[model samples]
Target chain A: MPWRRPRKKVERPIEVTRSIEESLEDAAAGEEEEDSVDLAGLDDATVVEAATGEPEPERGASDLALKLRETLAREPAPARARPRATTYPESGVDLAVDAARGLRLRNPVLTASGTFGQGIEYAELIDVARLGAIVNKGTTPNMRPGNPQYRIAETPSGILNSIGLENPGAVEVARRYGVQWAALGVPVIVNVAGYSVEDYVYVVSEMAGTPGVVAYELNVSCPNVKDGMIFGSDPSLAAELTRAVKAETDLPVIVKLTPNAPDVVAVARACEEAGADGVTAINTVLGMRIDTRRRRPILGTGSGGLSGPAIRPIAVHITYQVAQAVGIPIMGAGGVTSAEDALEFLMAGASAVQVGTATFADPLVPLKVIEGLAAYVREHGLRSIREIVGTALPRMVE
Target chain B: MIIQQGAVTASARIGDLGTVLGVSAPGIAAQARAGQFVHVRPGTSFEPLLRRPYSFNRIRRQEGEIELIVRPLGPGGEWIASRRPGDLLDLLGPLGTAFVIHRSARNLLLVAGGTGIAPMRVLAEQEASRRNVTLLMGGRSVAYLWPSDRLPPSVEYVTTTEDGSFGIGGRVTEALPELLRWADQLCACGPWPMLAAIGRMREEAERAPAAPGRAALLEAQIAVEQHMGCAMGVCRACVVVTSQGNARVCREGPVFPLGDVAFAEGEPATVGLVS
Candidate 1:
């Protein structure tokens, strides 16, 4: 008698088929699961993929009997019933927060300037409408060619960059992105960077009525260009620039502070006194990495701005100090990669958190943060995320 | 620009040149074109942070597989090169512009240096069936040259090693003149110095009344490399100066026309106001 091998288990296939039938029944019964599975509407390739482990190509291996035998031998579980998680907006949690004096956002997570481009670059990979808002690349009065080659270098737990505010100028940006911004569903925050108060005023006046632009975040903290740090480093200049921009546009003006400043809290206080709606706690720290073999700096510009997890603590500290010094809301930035990190800023007295360098590592981080914040609200039995703001601040009056 | 999770199906060590990994990514493979690259996450976490970009060495649409030549340069590259069969890779790609071969061209020349052979090899395989193809490559030594047996048999392979351990003694440029004479079009991908050398040739050709391969040199296209961040157009890193002003290597390029690119002393010219 010929030796015969035992038939492979068909348990997974049966489970997949059973799951499909269960989903169909649930849909027919008008169950509340919004993402119901409808096999009938699926394409033939998808149906084949559901039955088989992989999609069958149109050519080569199209023999019917071979496909059936292969499908049977493979453990196909394409239709497994996964635990359904509620979407962020419908999670019955209040995540609304005032990012600026007049900028009311549905959530407290925003994309940082210089990292999110014009918000259109990532629209293909993610749903931009889910974010609280998006801050576009820092725009200048005139088009900048940007820095030289080797604009980026990897540090220990961060990255150093010297991209010198490369943009198509303020007028061009507003003209090119105005219509798309209106359709993106997410509010737009224009990041204004310039060499003088006149430049800032020029950019603001040009972008005054652009669609979807809810506010202006003054980028006074760029570390890669000559005189870029002038306004951010000097409290008087920052306040002056803030007042000038607020005069030009009716939109809320939020000043972005730099960690390189001698007194970051003083800058925040000055901006607040100058009628600014809010302030971003911190921008990238100035840092450098030298190439041993080349005997020179790694970046095209010797000293570049450092960002990522390495600067998170510094940002939180600045946020805490600035919150105490000023009455306006603080938009914390620098190296916020996860929900826990965002919560750190929130508890430290920041009204909203900006996901920056981390977006380069993972594009879905902002969405994850929104979901995680909602989960936190549900877990803590809190009515709104705002209830936790400044919870970690010292209760004792100085 | 879809982020697809690819499974490793095959891995081979190509002498001392590099390690080649065959990945099954149907979505990326189907839409991939010559000169396009995939940004691969080094690991599941963000330790290495930014993703490493790798050009496709082979795109087999029928098999739903793409091949990459990964040379372990640092921790991130080592992690990617160490992946074995069944290992999953998160790839964001088929990104950037591709080399466009004019329909009139019957003779095509592809020049490569170092690991730049990734895209050059792709062009050879893609154009070999319909046209006469020649691949000219150079490396420091014989160990760095791609194995001719692995390439399409119809592709004419010529190489040079600095130490004279391979076919030709000097650099790829030493053999480029002969190939340029017989070619109607030229495409190169390599380090800054090699590309800058080609840029000089293009300048000379355009200046002279009638130089050999003048039209081809003027129309040559080259893919460049730079220290990149976000591979997406967001970060503004990896920018090179061009006749059209600043262009992002991740968005506008990784591929550019020979005459359009600006070079300064064997490197991409610095943009913005120099200190």
Candidate 2:
């Protein structure tokens, strides 16, 4: 007789169907357990079972199949449940923060001074009411025509601007944008830039009763104009200017610090001592770009203030240092493009953040940052975003 | 003005002139007028940040397509120019003010220089069928000249090259006086020097006695270019001194009446008095 294999035993279709049903039931039960039960307490085999949703081995199964099933069942569940730990909160996390002592806002994101022109310009493109507040273009006691041609130039990841604080006089700005600002439903932080303490007082006095004016952002560091940075760079001048403005208006006074200052922290401290409610750490760093082809500087002024991601690290360091040194709130500015960047400032002790040149790249950046912060808050299961503020600071030994 | 992602359908180098890109942006094309421009994002990242503003080189509303003439100069411009078909572009437009064409005017003169031909080309095509339109374009040389075939057949095209390699030998100013007399209205877009030349001519006409087309020169509208930021009115980076005050190029203009723009030494006049 020819060599013949032993007669193979074939299982009935009904039997096969029953086995499959048993296997599926086991898998379903494993998946249910994985969904409802905490996997952290489970053993390695149970975790593998939960992960793979594989059924237990059947009787008469091949050795190979048994071994594979055993290996899968023994494998540990993936390190963590998932990257996102918690669902978005029903009420959502609060993004509100204070720009100054009494200048509380619904969000921590505000438009930087000068970058946002009186809230009316960007109001057409975005919902202005969503912003923490808007710091209007630098306004003076008198109308300014601003810098010459080529007032702006693009640097690596930032913008260099020498706009020379161009604005209609305080009267005109108040007259032109008062109703518009009120209508926009966004608080206005008047950016006051002046040649002297008297000029600052004049501007504050001019804007005293303007509707929607919530506070004042003293732009003492406008590097584009002559003598504009004097008050910002000198502690005494800054203190005097802050005191004069404080005397003029009951509005919260925020001194915008200039990085070009020989000692920025001293100026901040002086302003705070002079009754400033808050300080915006670090204005644009002075920078220059030359057009090799033209054989000359690109800006009308040889130097312009650089603002963007290029200055973000420097801004954060300053905010961190100032936050430790000052008692008043710190409004962090300079290259705050995302919620993470804002969070960096917040954790470093900033009470709020201002978005500047990044707005040039994307008008919706501030809004996006707000959304991102909310997402972060929910994911980390933080009760409130403010809980993260100053978390990165060194603790006191006392 | 809306921001939309437009897809490039075609891109090609137009000799030594610039790269021409056709983007399918229905919203921008539908609302676009002659002098309005689109701020195009260079890349997905913010490395070479800041959108590049380009006046629409060609707009086809029915087809929902817009064209841009991009000179690959900076990294941003190079990135925009190198875009191929199917690439997406972020566009914010049709922004800024548009060139205003008076309906009653029978004769319309459009002047352009170098890349400024973008808006002028649009004016030529749009006004060709409605009025007696003449487009006077000047470039540094033959390399910078806009292709004649791209213009509408109805438009009367005149060109000047500084090198005498094309049309009239010299600047558009050389060919402008005779045409200014023939035209009832004038619109121009060009470099600061070229626009300043026209502004000087307008000033001269205003000082002298009334003559044919003198009024047109006085009322001429020109689209200007500057080192722009935000393209939105917010940045205040593109302000040029105007008769009224400092006017934002992105809002008050890219288009302004020639008489309103202030020029000093062939550039936008600087505001000398800060106070």
The lDDT values for all models are 0.82, 0.80
Worst 10 residues of 2 chain B by lDDT: B266-275
Stretches of candidate 1 off by over 4 Å are A1-91, A222-229, A396-398
Candidate 1 per-residue C-alpha lDDT over B52-122 given as tens digits, one digit per residue, 9 for 90 to 100? 99989999999999999999889889999999999999898878778888889999999999889999999
lDDT tens readout by residue for model 1, A203-276: 99999888778899998874324455578889888898999999999888999999999999998999999999
Judge candidate 1 at residue A284 and give its lDDT: 92
User: Candidate 1, chain A: TM-score?
Assistant: 0.77
Interface RMSD of each: 13.8, 24.4
Per-residue lDDT of B164-212 in model 2, one digit per residue for the tens? Answer: 9989999999999999898899999999999999999999999999999
Clashing pairs in 1: none
lDDT of 2 at A37: 60
